[model samples]
Target chain A: MSTTVEMVRRPSSGAEQAPPSGALGRLRWAVVDGWVMTGRNMRHVIRSPEEIVLYFSLPIMFVLVFGYVFGSGMAVPGDGSYREFLLPGVFVMTMLYGLGATASQIAVDTGRGVVDRFRSLPMARSALLTGRAGADLLRALLELTVLVVCGLLVGWRWRNGVGDALAAVGLILLLRLAFTWLGILLGLLVPNPDTVSVIVFPFAFPLTALSNVFVAPELLPDWLGAIAAWNPLSATVAAARELFGNPGTGGESWAAQHALLLAVGWPVLLIAVLAPLAVRRYQRLSR
Target chain B: MTDETSAVVARGLRKTYGRTTALDGFDLTVPRGTVCGLLGPNGAGKTTALRVLTTLLRFDAGHARVAGHDVTRRPERVRAAIGLTGQYAAVDETLSGRQNLVLFGRLRHLPARMVRQRSDELLDQFGLTDVAGRSAATYSGGMRRRLDLAASLITTPEVLFLDEPTTGLDPRSRNGLWDAIRTLVTGGTTVLLTTQYLEEADQLADRISVVDAGRVVAEGTPAELKTRFGADRIELVVRHAGQLPAAAGLVERVTGGQVHVDRETRRLSAPVADRITALADLLRALQDASIAVEDVVLRRPTLDEAFLNITGHGASERTEVAA
Candidate 1:
């Protein structure tokens, strides 16, 4: 400690100076800085693979229990089997639950004072949020892969060709992206990770369970069915079913008929609303 | 680059959270390359003042400058020149010590090679080289704090803000931290420290500012503040327990200060002035009376007494402090 103090007291070389000068140069560094932050967050996930496994476990459990236990007497009123019909809903449910991960991560970061540390640096304002979003998107892709494999193991096959199947996976990820912004918004708004889980539970449980993911909205009471049909989760699930060429293809509702468009529209709309809200929440944090 | 010679300056900083006022018209100025101790109780606006200056928070009304840059208008410039180590460790627990340093170095835009070298240098300097590969979560409290301090120093910031940096450390760790802080100041890093521990302030600060009710109530050198607000104490421990009363009377007459006698310990204490003459007179009087004395000492008022005198209360007085 004393030697370092002496080293600092004397004039040192300017080796650790700022990277570059000018506005344009800073803008370039900002992009690179964001990538560095992304790598930092990704390293955490790598170090703790068990955490990722635990997060993935929930969706897998839901698939088996719902597929086997409920599949025995279940009917889809279409050519596709109930197991096939349940696959897309389970995927959507996984993505929906992923919103909590984003929220809790942000809450933990904020509570730990890492957010303040980042804010105090000369780095770009968007680096922290963008870095988190990047890691979460990668995580979402991993979960999607696991769920797809599990779906195959449980007799849920995608009859559609490569192009359509890829599109369905893309839609699921797009929904994840939308929910990621919502998570960021909630994370910034809440005080801690525990509170984030508490708040997210009420919304996630009802929204995922009532949507067309688990049961047809048409089977529910009239008002609830209308709500379920219009739910953003329902649109994504219906779209995934259509893309995978699964049976029970959203049965006769106008929402089912236009699944692909609504699936794309819901995420776009959510991003448009939640992304700015998240940014604003971040900016107004200590104000 | 700017005309301001002080490392930090804040004027009329006012911040409120609903009905509670965290900072109310607070003002401070810390000179360049000097340690400024912001001493106050738990609910005092010490942390709030730091947050505003570091650009981590926005005050409702204030004009603050750090490293000659306007904190609100030119925050990036201020941030570039300043580093803040908050009350919490503020480190990524999952990352190794070296990894945390590298992450901060990269964020500060240091060259990749420079970052690696700097991380190694800092880890060695802070005696963290052996554990640099381990996650910070595995570190002892002292080690985590050292790592946190290293993270803030990645770019050799012009001004460092340490808010209660040693709130929970043992005596050994606290001393280690104080040594590190002294080294930083010797190297010409201006520091603004806020701590509830009066000893920490006395050990670290060149100038001490007593903050209470969201503003500075008193500001001066530690010696000056102590002299102004504290009195010298004269203590006499008699060889015979029965001599306690006689010693107390002799000391009271010599010093003319309030005297407190503990008969069980046979100790007599009194606040005194003109320490040299008071001690001389008291000793001579006791000698003439043939009173046996085991110990005689004149002690200056402790920082705790000075703090309580200036703040009008102890640090434990948390009620209505935020208001």
Candidate 2:
């Protein structure tokens, strides 16, 4: 066994210096470390093309199956294609589904002792959580890009032009960011990746099903429609549909009328409520 | 009690998980440039103490200073000075060996150029140069552990903690890790290792702290602990089975100790305080009686025996009261 005598004998120079102190220095290091961690996660996605394919297939399958198999039977509340009405919901649903990946990845890291190793290092405390959020957002961007092309191929054009369309994409990402924080929290709370996988579906299915992701909220019974319209996932889906100039934007409920406000408000609120709790849980992981 | 001479020091450290106490008044002191093994059974608080000292876990009360910085108040400083290889191989399995080292070096704030250079050097040193590009998931158990250790040494920390570093490894891999640890200590890095294997403690540690029920039950050098627990024993096998009784009587008369005679094996055994003199007299007495001896040996108590004597239980037995 060759010893690490060379490592000890060499002059460490700047490498041995203490991490910079103070708020600004800390924030700067946090960004640097978080980026490094993000790069690691991105590499995982790149190396495992099958994982990317698996995630992308879900959204693409929804687009094809809903657009072709069920298009003739389904009805839109407004004068637009059923494919158009369904595409926005599918985009938002894909983002919601991403919650499982984020949660399971974090849970795997924690269960496998990777997070403990990070915690023992001198890097910024928030780097792991922030890195997860950043990587998931980037991944959500890729998924959206692919889904957008798929939607365009299926005759689901955004009639609201470029600016409103960009806003719609932004709302979908915002919802993804909020769900990212929720995923981080759940990942930290859950014991392992298998448990996260088991629980995320039961939690996410009801969320997407009860929302306006599929049927227009107005089509459901009065009591059920109220719950579906107010669902957080519904807000983003409705907002995205309105922004894209797609059909199924009609509803008398305050939530549907204020979809744009709720789209932004719900995400911001979820982030505000979940981010700090996740951070606190990470800091108190040993307890 | 932070001091330059002590790499790790703990005084009355206490931690509880609701109703269960994980660390109750745990105390230790590891001098710089030496290996201190925290030897214990399962659920014996060894890992908890290691976590607390490494700044991965917070203790409820008392104090700890690691690498001359207060553990609770100056955890970042402690973290900066220390490297910890947890019981599990914590290397990123998705990453190649070189990438794992580079990532850790970058996290430690090394310059990009330095990170690359250091990672290459580590890969070469650990004999992973051939497989440096392969993902750690494809590496064997020993290779992954070597990568884990290499990752921890990215910054050549002043203090390193290994929590059962060879827990699940085969003997060959375990020996390889032991040799690596020996080389590291020779390079002057202070190491505090926790292990349930008494042989591991004896092989690696300069000082061993026997832990039981969340506290240090005994602390000493391996030899010192062995001698403290029991005396050396002299055993001889008689060539003639009929001479076993004669040898036993002569052994007791010469050594002034009770002799255990095994007629089937024609063996006589007795514990001796003055090992050398007792052995010499026993051999002379047996020769005088014309009782030929086939084999003779002196055996000191093993660390396993010392641990059992100190903890009042075998090292592998889990104590119910320990949380």
* Interface RMSD for each of the candidates: 2.9, 2.1
lDDT score for candidate 2 against the true structure: 0.88
Candidate 2 deviates by what RMSD?
2.6
Quality class of the docking in candidate 2, CAPRI style = medium
Candidate 1 per-residue lDDT, tens place, A48-138, comes to 8899789889989999999999877776855568999999999988988998989998888877777788988888888888888888888
* Top DockQ hit: 2
Segments of candidate 1 deviating more than 4 angstroms: A1-30, A154-160, A215-225, A250-252, B1-3, B234-272, B277-296, B315-323
- Against the reference, the lDDT scores of all candidates come to 0.86, 0.88
C-alpha positional error of residue B265 in candidate 1 after TM-score superposition, expressed in Å: 6.3
Q: Give the CAPRI class of candidate 1.
A: acceptable
Off by over 4 Å in 2: A1-4, A8-17, B1-4, B18-20, B239-243, B280-296, B317-323
Candidates in order, TM-scores: namely: 0.88, 0.93
